[model samples]
Target: MATSVLVLGAGFGGMELATVLSDELDEAEVTLIDKGDSFVFGYSKLDVMFGREPAAAVKLPYAEFTKPGVTPLREEVTQIDPEAKRVVTDSGEHEGDHLVVALGADYDFDATPGLAEVDSEFYSVAGAEKMAAAIPEFSQGRAVIGVCGAPFKCPPAPSEAALLLNDDLISRGVRDDCEITFLMPLPSPVPPSPETSEALLAEFADRDIHFVPGARIA
Candidate 1:
């Protein structure tokens, strides 16, 4: 009998795992599930946020994941019954010999007060689109890009936002009239890599972006 596997989520880890399993177990049936209709990568997300890439370009369709032994299902998994070896979704219940949970990380904007209400280009795709649309309208003044909290999904995204915002200002011919500030709780712009840190610092200095290093926003 062929082994039945159910993989939840279509994120980075999940998608890779599913593909590998399908390749390894030629006779096995693998089902990939996620609540989201499409997959948007972390780096590609920034492009959409900056209005450099259209939303459609960033969305990876599930239909394109058709492999010999892999089945892609679009359904919201509501609950998991470990003992019973079954999963329940809006579509129906699925029984599996093996189950992998890979729902990915969710954004908690409400963790900090005033964040959910504030205009943030980093949180949601819709939020990014909204900010992108609003950017061209603002002719002058301060464009404060702030990130509150640590261990966020994408670490370099804030710095990228700062750089992109600076580029946007310059392109609009109002860079001199506007000030871009990066608010984060890091000692360096990029925490993991020293080279990235130095490069980011130099970029910040060159672009005249105010860096609030080690500063926590309350």
Candidate 2:
């Protein structure tokens, strides 16, 4: 009998794992499942947030992917039985020889008191698009890029947003009018690498972007 592998949340990790397993092991049955029908790259979200690309242009449909021994299913995962190697989804339940769970982190806006009430959150696609639309109308004010919590995915995203916002304001000829501030709980922008952090600090200083270290946004 062929070995069956079940994978959840067809993100980058899930997709790559399924593809590699299917390609390498011909007799293996790979089932890749996700709640959404398509995949969107993280960088694409930044592009959309910065008004560099539209949302439609960044989505890659899973239906277009063709791989032997690999099956892609769009279903919401309701439960997971890790010991039994079984998964229950909205459509049905499935049992497999191996189960891989790669579902990424979920953002909780209510975790912060006033986060949901804020104008935008660039972490999500919808929020990014909304902020992108609002960016053009923002003529003069303090633009704060902050992380509500620590140990979030993509540590460099906040810094990237600050630099991009600076570029956008400069392009609009309103750079001087807008003050950009980036807040993080880390002692430095990139704590793992001191050289990289120094480079980032230099860039922030040159661009007149305020860097608030060891700070947390409420």
Q: Give Cα distance to truth, residue 104, candidate 2, Å.
A: 1.1
Best by TM-score: 2
Kindly list the per-residue Cα lDDT of model 1 for residues 56-80, writing each as its tens digit: 8888898888777888899999999
- CA lDDT, every prediction? 0.84, 0.90
Clashing pairs in 2: none
Q: Count the backbone clashes (under 3 Å) in each candidate.
A: 0, 0
Residue pairs with colliding backbones in model 1 are none
| Tens-digit lDDT string for candidate 2 (186-217) | 99998888998999999999999999999988
